[model samples]
Target: MVERLTRAVLAAPRTVLVGALALLVLFGLYGGGVASHLLSGGFEDPHAESAQATKILEDEYQRGGIPVIFKIDAPNRDVTADPVVGRVGKQLVEDLKQYDFIQDPVLSIWTDPVAARNLISKDKSSTLVVVPLDGGEDAAPGHAEDLAERFGGERDGVRITPTGQGKVFADTNTQVSKDLFLAEAIAIPISFIALVIIFGGVIAALLPLAVGIFSIVGTLALLRVFALFADVSIFTMNLATAMGLALAIDYTLLIITRYREEVAGGLTREAAIHRAMATSGRTVTFSAITVGLSLSGLLLFPQYFLRSFAYAGLAVVVVALLGSLVITPALLKVLGDRIDALDLRKPVRRALGRPERGFVPTEQTWWYRFVQWVLRRAAPVMLITTVVLLILGAPFLSIKLGFPDDRILPTSHASRVAMNEIRDDYERKLGGEVTIVITGSTDAAVDDYAARLSKVADVDAVTSPDALFVDGRAAAPRKSEDRHGEYRILTVTSNTDPLQDSGKTLLANLREVAKPDADVKFTGTAAATEDTVASIYRHLPWVLLWVAVTTFILLFLFTGSVVLPLKALVLNLLSLSATFGAIVWIFQDGHFGALGTTATGFITATMPILMFCVAFGLSMDYEVFLLGRIREEWLKSGKTRADSDHAVAFGLANTGRVITAAALLMAIVFAAMMASQVSFMRMFGFGLTIAVLMDATLIRMLLVPAFMRLAGRANWWAPAPLRKLHDKIGLSES
Candidate 1:
């Protein structure tokens, strides 16, 4: 199949180039508009109980909860005594009524002064005007952005700063968009320099960028098409851009390096392209499939935020695979010997008074000698590296998971500023209130339930239809909004942030309280977070199984050895564990003060899953590259322990530089994400950087060769039936 494709490509290289150019233009034009169709929020599981409860709260109770909380401050003066504050606050409520989506009765000190006492700060200088938008989750952030733009600034000495889940999500979406552009701006130039240095020429350095452009634009166009069928998260765009360039460079480097090796071996440029296609081209195909399968694990998650990565990853990989297989080869066919033009190494060679080196590496190469040294002391080297990996991974045992809040945004953001004010200056977290609904419950039963709920630890107050309860004692009569026909609603306020341990414990205790069993449902930020985390964990095992099974099978087919696949999985886990531990120490434990991020005390719920899939797949990518060359060399030599050692050393010499370069280039792409304002983006960048570097250096370069030497001839071992199966289907250099 590759031979046939190579013939078709060599026959019409110019035609292939023209087709790619045409696609580049079309995709570029359409992909630019993808932002219009993306969503800012998709972290909730739509099928979870909390989601259903939210529907009831919105439809039956006419309470959408607060999307935007406006902190109205009078600057060290009492709000009631300042005429400007009173007039502006009243007018703000009136202005809110003009928006049809805003719930009919906005909550503020002016409108419900008695019930909104919790909205006032302890000093009486600041109060809140809570605007509850009636739209569902998708439209809420857009509404918040509009409201924040219109009424979020100061009006006659009364400052109105908006903050809440809605505003925070909006800010996150906007920041991610900016970070995407900034990350590219940073990654592209640095990557070009790295590419030039690695390839040792200017012309070859530009080929990967061409592939990157095609992959990115094509994936964006595909995502825009996907948006028509389902809600896609804006975060998917960031992944697409980063992975598109990364995979392109990885595949392009291997293909070009192989072609150069073949050319230096006295083959015609056309024959070299064909030979490179048969070997490196096959590796690219399997590597992409391995990555796509790993990303498919995200589909098991109910959250669209995760599933969207599956879509983005598959699109980028497929597009990059095509660019690598079709576009890269076509460019090579056209460039031919000129691919080595404008050699960047020539100037260096001149200054050193040396001649240019050819493509072929020798036994004197650093990787060959390095592998020999590792083989001599295989056991100790293996044991020491294993211990180091385990020690670095120890911090992952202490990982705590939570959902991101306004803190995910920079502290300079308006929503983050407002959240900080409420956290420090306000006695009550009005935005942190939890709501419970019970249908067909008697007033007596609800009053009893609310009283018990109010007595739970960390519960400040509970308002039921009968009366407001504070610490199990009735304080005042409740309002009509608390009752709707036979359905009773209770508002539970806590002094702690709902995302914290105390608040989660409070919710757990509330669930333990005895109720009428009349379809009681909890709906609020805390409830949604609980359900989202549960949904992820419930399907997490299946996700891991899918990634492991698919990857093991793919590696088995690629290497024709059951032992190699098993070893690959174990090594990938070890490296990924170290990466996760670093994430906990830096992002969760707040040990990296120079990163300028606020530690949320827990990793984001989906981050580990997302990182595991991406990093494991990429780790396996290098695994395949190294193993492919070793397998080729092994098959050509006699099947003996010494022959196996020779194959390992020779393969490392041939491919190590390329693998290390690809890993270095991939790391550079992810490292650009560290410049992002969002803490998770920074975590994502730093974590991937560590994973690729560790996999390339410690796992691939040192541990793999050492372990292979220890295993000796068994590195290629398989059961009789499986060996026959592999002989029939395994990829080879034939």
Candidate 2:
């Protein structure tokens, strides 16, 4: 199969070159506007999930369905009751009271009746106000926060805590935009250097980078179109680019390495390219299929965000795979010796002539000795590592997932400074954040319930709103109209995290307190954040599980051996688990000092699973490149398991230096993300770097062969009936 692919790569070098060029042109035009024909940027980045969700909420509000809530909090409750307080405080309170778009802030003390009751506070020591914000179509919500700075009027104690559709949109956009650029900035330089170093030849390395870039552009363009039918998140867009870039390098790495080997073996440039392709191309195919299948696992999830991410991710990978195999081989064919054009260092020449190379891979190294030692203790080593991973990963078992309280912060950020002010100082005045619900019977449930709600909890405040119906239409008081019943607006406050456990617990209590007296539903930033976090967690495992299983099957089909596929699954998982531990250790546990950010309690939540899927796909580079030669030896010698294992390790030793070099290059690319201010990106960058290091060293260099030694001939065994079937149809490396 390898020979066949190499032949094909050699056979039609121009066609492959042309196709690669075309894809580049197409994708460039699509994203950067250099290529005029591929412009796909009218809407939001189609892969960014937060953008899609915001759009949905926008649509809901526009339809006159959900009332917008605008919450305000002022600091320093004590030094009150100057004439200026009545004048400025009353005016600010009045402005919100008259807002047409703003609905009753269910638990605010600043609105009409609620404010009246709370402002006097029995001793008349303080005053408060709730404002209704009803900015119609395309209200620039960011402007509202600005309103706070304006209304506070150089005063320290008065402030507004905005919470409405506009705030949500503003916060989401702010976060996504920052991460996107941060990721690009941190990744690109490191990635470029990694590419240059790994190839030793500039053009050779750039090809994969070019492929990855094109995939990013093309997939975004494709996603823009898909957005008509699905929701995409801003976070997902950044992630897809990262994913595509990593995968493209991985695919190209396998093929490039194979092509170099073939060229050295004396094939003409074209023949070498073909032979490399035909062989490495199978690896590419299997690798792509595994990655695609794994990402497809996101589809089992109910959240539109995950589903959208899955589809977009899958599309990018397919395109990257195509570029690696169908397009890349052809480019290699034409480039011939020029593929290594930037070889100013004369590395190959130095390598071929010298024997003093400390860098060259050899069994005499300490690493080789360590592998030998580990091999002798394989069972014990494996068992110990497995137990360690399980214990470290145990935190996930008791995991409580929820959207962040300060969604805008990585917890270290300062926008959260604003939230701290509200939660601490503001809560002293009102025991908790308020949740206002307008409730009533089918006749006048909303109005009556509003009044009932005011009287329910720590109701120190009351907002007696004028009769407001769900729609603008007013019901006749004496008529049989359902909306004619009395409606009173009320606000109640409580203390809670609103997104995490304490918040959820408080919410449950609040619900139980209010449910018996009125027909009411409590939905606010805190509650909604909980739902969002729950949604991601509820579906994440399924996404990962399906991705792994599907990757297993895809690998099985590619190798045509059930045993080989199972082995693929195990190695990938083992490496991934170790990676997760390292991520937790570095980012959450702060195993290292002052990583330049406050350590959140856990590895930035969503990153572990995403990293797993990504690393599994990338790890296939070693799996295919190293194992290809091993399979060849096994088929030829038909020897004992140990012999084949030795052959594999010997081939690996030959290739190990190059692959380890590549892994180092790649690890640098990932680690560059540590330069980002965004904590999650840093976590991802660090975690991936660690994972690649382990994969190249421990797992690939040591564990795989040691296990193969243990499995012996059983390693190659498919079921007996399946053996003949595979022999009849399978394409073996042999």
Candidate 3:
């Protein structure tokens, strides 16, 4: 099938090129605005209890949405005592009222003294003006930006800084865009230099980069299509571009290197393209399927953040694979003998001793010698590598998962700085206080419930219609009507970080104490974090099962061996454990301060799962690339133990250089994201870079050969029924 497709593409290279160009243009034009359509928040499970509570509050009370907070600083003056500051605050409130997007009756120091106690800074030098936006988070950023532009700096003896969910998200989106550009700017040139070194010719190097560019643009366009139907995360753009570029380089390197090898072996250009497509092209296809299947596991989670990556990853792999299989072969056919043109570094090739046409220089190559060394000491090498991986993975046992917050932004950012101030001075007053909606309840019942909640460990205070409870007592009697008048709203404050265990424990205690007849539901940042974590873990087993089972099946089809599939899965998981542990050590545990990122004390909840799927899929991608060659050699050499040994060495020698080059290219691209201002992106960059480097060198180069040597012919064994099934439907490059 691959041969037939390549022959047809080669037969009409210009036609195929034109079609590809047309699709590129169409998708680029249509999907160019994908960023505008992407969302900034997808941290909550939409159907979780917290989400349901939020919805009810938003619909009935008009109060549960994210608030736009303005930190107004009045130097050397108490905000309330200073007439100028008070006048400016009034004017700001009036200005906000003129905008339809701002909710009515904004809360500020001038509105109510009771609320003002919390809104005002402790030194009286600053105050907070909080207002809910009309369109929730999606509409808040624009309004916040407009408000900031209008009332940002030094207005009537006060400086206003916007620091809220809206401003934070807007800033994050802007930073991610800049980071994407920066990563591309750094990655592209470095990748080109590396490719030039690997291929030893400029023309040969440019082909992979061209495919990478095409794949990135095509995937972006595909993301635009997805954006039309669902809310994609802005973060997805980073994943799409990174994965697209990496996979393009990977698949192109595999195919083009094979084609060059076949051409150097004296095959006609047509036959060389056919043979390259039959072997490397088939490998690229299987690699794409395995990667696509692994990433599809992310879709099982409800968060759009994870789902968006799945969409982006699948698009990148498919588009890059198609580009490698179709366009690369077509371009190879057109280039023919000139594919090696623009050779600037001929001395290195001469030193390496270029082989004659129709011959591969395995005996003279370094990779062959390396594989020979590994084979001679396979058992010890395997033990050492496994031990190293396990030790590196040890830190993952202490990983603490939490939701991302303004801390994800650099501390130098205004929103982050302002939020830190808020967290330090007025944490008890901050809006993450847990809210409970009790339906079918009287005011007296709600008062009792609020009193009981206040007594829960870690609960700082609770507010209800009848009274305010503080330190487990009714500190003051209050009169207030439920805005909706249908359900009682009980607000509880905790002294613990809402995303951490203390706050989650307090929330659980609150739920346990609430009367079943109260018809109670909890909602807040802590509740949402709790629910999001639970939701992800609830679906995690299924996702892992799906990825494991499907990937096993895909590997079986590729290698026709159950043991190899299981072995590959184990090795990939081991490498991923190392990656996760590194993330925990560097980002969570704050061991690597040189990276210019502060530790958040917890990894983002979705990052581990997303990284596992991405890294595992990419591991499987390289697995397919290596195993395809080894499988071919095994079939050709008659599958004897001696032949199996020869096949492992020969296959490693033939493909090792390409695999290393591709891994280097991928690692460089991912590492470029470390330059990002966001801590999560840095963690992602560091984790993936480590994973690729380790997979390509230690696992693929040393461990794989060692394991195969130990397994011998057993590496190719399958049950008779399974063998018959594989014979009927399995993919073979031979």
> Using TM-score as the measure, which candidate wins?
1
Per-model TM against the reference? 0.97, 0.75, 0.96
Please write out the lDDT profile of model 3 over residues 414-507, one tens digit for every residue: 9899999987766354754898888887776777777888888877789887788987689998876553566888888666778767777877
Residue range 88-186, candidate 1, lDDT tens digits: 988988888888888755778888865577788888899888788866556788898899999988887778888887788778878988999999999
- Per lDDT, the best of the predicted structures is 1
lDDT of each: 0.87, 0.56, 0.86
| Model 2: lDDT to the true structure | 0.56
True-structure RMSD, every candidate: 1.6, 7.2, 2.1
TM-score of 2: 0.75
Regions of candidate 2 where Cα sits further than 4 Å from its true position:
1-26, 32-110, 113-172, 347-377, 387-398, 407-414, 428-492, 508-522, 525-545, 582-594, 597-608, 620-622, 728-731
lDDT of 3: 0.86
User: Candidate 3, TM-score vs. the true structure?
Assistant: 0.96
Which of the two, 1 or 2, has more lDDT?
Answer: 1
Q: How do all the candidates rank in terms of lDDT, highest first? A: 1, 3, 2
For model 2, residues 1-734, the per-residue Cα lDDT tens digits are 44555466557778767766787777656554211121111122222332333333334332221222333333344324455544555566566544445544433343344234433333343443433344422243444454444453433454434444344444545555566567667666677776776666677778877777777777766666565565554456655667667667777887788777777667786666666666667766766666666666666655454566577778778877766776677677677678989854476667678543334334565545655666677777776665765665554443333332243345443344444443444434322444443345343444454445444334333232343322223222222121223322233444444444555665555455434345443445444544455555666777767766766555555555687778777877877776776666655665674266555454433455567666776687667666766676566775785675566556566567667876876676567556555556566677777878888886777667677766767777777787777767666553
For all candidates, the clash counts are 0, 49, 1
Candidate 3, position 14, lDDT? 85
